[model samples]
Target chain A: MSTDTPANSESALSPEEVAELRSRVDELETELSTLRTEMDDDSKKMVIIATKGTLDMAYPPLILASTAAAFGYDVTVFHTFWGLEILHEENSKDLKLSSVGNPNLPVPNAIAALPGMDRMTTRMMRGKIEDNDVASVEELVRTSLDSGVDLQACQMTIDLLGYDEDDFYEGVTTGVGAASAFQEMVDADIQLLV
Target chain B: MSTETTETLDVKGQNCPMPVIKTKGAFDELADGETLEVVATDAGSVSDIAGWADSTDGAELLDQTEASEDGETVYKHYIRKAE
Candidate 1:
């Protein structure tokens, strides 16, 4: 680098010049703060793909979407495949927690396959949920809707499952295809598959 | 430090998402510059409340304190409504 001493190196700026510089700094500061506030108000977006239907799997997407909404995020949960069971009017409340094929299940595989094991496991898990003060899946879904989180069910999945458009809970957006879900996911600041 | 109205929200015995969710609901009812005092028993709320405040433009976390009540550790957070 070439070091060059400017003619003003030994001279102080005039009072008028200092005042102009101070005003410029103030204007810049104002602009910076305005920009910051605008950015914050714009709010971030989050999108989640919920593809599981079991009682154990339902909580993640709903809980995350609701929490993100609470944090002032524009949140969306796209339900596809078995995930649509979460929004199903009749099936949501009865979604079962199965022990079969779940390594996390404490019981051995053979015992897990016994008759009525799924119901037993579901009841046990629900008890644990209640003891810990965890909100139920139904409560979380309602909370998500009340907090302005978009809950969309896949149109293709509904047709595949022979479910009517009105099969989901009220306020749930029906008939969202993969393309629309992708549209939401592409612009989101955060995306998750659960 | 302003004399704006301060509201108290007790989320004791609740876990993650509940505390934050209830805090958001309470803040929605607050006027701009009002303060909200949150009392929670969840250990996760210490970071959850702060993170929520930091990320939400309409909320500002002012202070956090920890205390023991009935042999259970409690967390308190002071947040201000920012419009």
Candidate 2:
């Protein structure tokens, strides 16, 4: 059961045979370490910036973060400026896709600004998203957090906007300055601006 | 599909990341060299699970397949622990 019990204990191996086996072990170890290094290099780390606050913009960063995390990548999403709205506990619930300036819409700017136009447009967009099975912002964030994606709030923005830490969702790991978040992103293998 | 597994996980009706998240959790319960069988209903898991197992340091993907279950398709992935 022990390594000391040799494969052929009944007879001793010649010195040359022992030397050959030792060399073989050394070669295997080197090959294994090389493979290990290759694997390490291929493992991707993702850092994404969620800079836009609209419902349409919110889905991309959260979706990609969850997807990358599911691929066993270390993922982080940093929220700053208006993008922090997606992370806000109360505002997130009312997040809506804006139809303003959407080139795809056939309506002219004047019609687009009609009193009830925003609400109708938002409802239409929301319906399309649901019908298409696109992941909702809340669902995506849940998946991202459950997949171990770190959500960070930019402290400078939070202070400038006079928001408290508790204003964000439950899983915000850090409230850091923009520079700190960028530093983290710089070290990551993948960087995305959303 | 061809590999034998010591444990099996069913993540039916889940979407995208849940399958991989649950699979990773199952892998934690396995000892080195043991295989885990993960079954998921999410279409995205086909690539997600494979990529996760490949990129993970000590994870090995032994086998992968798809089969229909109750008129819907499901993905089955077998993984082996390496470290």
Candidate 3:
């Protein structure tokens, strides 16, 4: 960051330059602690990222977050873009699983996107999940919060989607900006981007 | 369900995240230094639970074992809550 670095190839750093460099080192150390104080300083911290809004993709991050919290790590889930809808009141209640454009979907993409196909696929998906005894999205969200996994919604995404505080589920933190969430994730010892 | 078990979490037939999700719920209710036994049918729990326990500070994973029964593999994890 210094342009005054020994302009002459053979010359060493001048005393003034050396003094400036040492001062810069001190400034850096001071800034390091300040940045670290940016978020909750839990000893064992974990972050789960939910960037995909699809119904199926929603479960992984929330489930992992709850479990990680149960393991005694403080956990936070940062949702952005489509992922933010996981906290939407009505949407989360009956989150629809889609086979459209998904390789894992049994039906062809074109067929999967047909009218009435979403409903059929959703029912089938729900039936299979229920039959397997997998935890439902609502159950997982409640469990995640109870397990101390903080659910944070992205401020930018919320505004971009034209959602208000009333739109999100109860207990969902709605004002988290990316800069703050990113810093929190950076401080966490373990992080998962799902 | 036994009193001595502190907590017993049954995640039978549930997959990866389900097992862990249940475990976290049960574990959070425990007082510091309490123990929990989680029984899961998901094969993924073996590493998933281990990774989780290792990543956190207060929870100490005593052990994890896998056994095959009736043609199904079950994983059990024993963890002690940190004081």
The numbered model that scores best in DockQ is 1
Residue lDDT tens for model 2, A21-127? 99999999999999898778865788988888887788778877876775678898999898888888788767876656887876787788778777788788888
Q: Look at candidate 1 and tell me the lDDT of residue A19.
A: 100
Candidate number of the best TM-score: 1
lDDT of 3 by residue, B1-83 (tens): 23245787888888767776667667778999788999888878888878877776687888787888889888889988988
Comparing 2 with 3 on DockQ, the higher-scoring candidate is 3
Rank the candidate models, highest DockQ first: 1, 3, 2
**lDDT (Cα, 0-100) at A153 in candidate 2:** 86
lDDT digits (tens) for residues B17-83 of candidate 1: 8999999999989999899999999999999999989987778888888999999999989999986
How many angstroms is residue A190 displaced in model 2 relative to the true structure, after the best TM-score fit? 1.8
> Per-candidate RMSD vs. true structure?
9.3, 11.8, 7.8
Tens-place lDDT digits, model 3, residues A93-162: 7777776777877899888878988788889888988887778888788878776679999998889989
Error of 1 at A102 (Å): 2.0
lDDT of each: 0.91, 0.82, 0.80
Instruction: Write out fnat for all predictions, comma-separated.
Output: 0.85, 0.30, 0.74
**How good is chain A of candidate 2, measured by TM-score?**
0.75
Residue clash pairs of candidate 3: A70-B24
Report the lDDT of model 2 for residue B77: 90
Q: Write the residue-wise lDDT of candidate 2 on B1-83 in tens digits.
A: 36878999998877655677778878888999899999887888888888888877789988888899899898999999986
Give the number of colliding residue pairs in candidate 1.
0
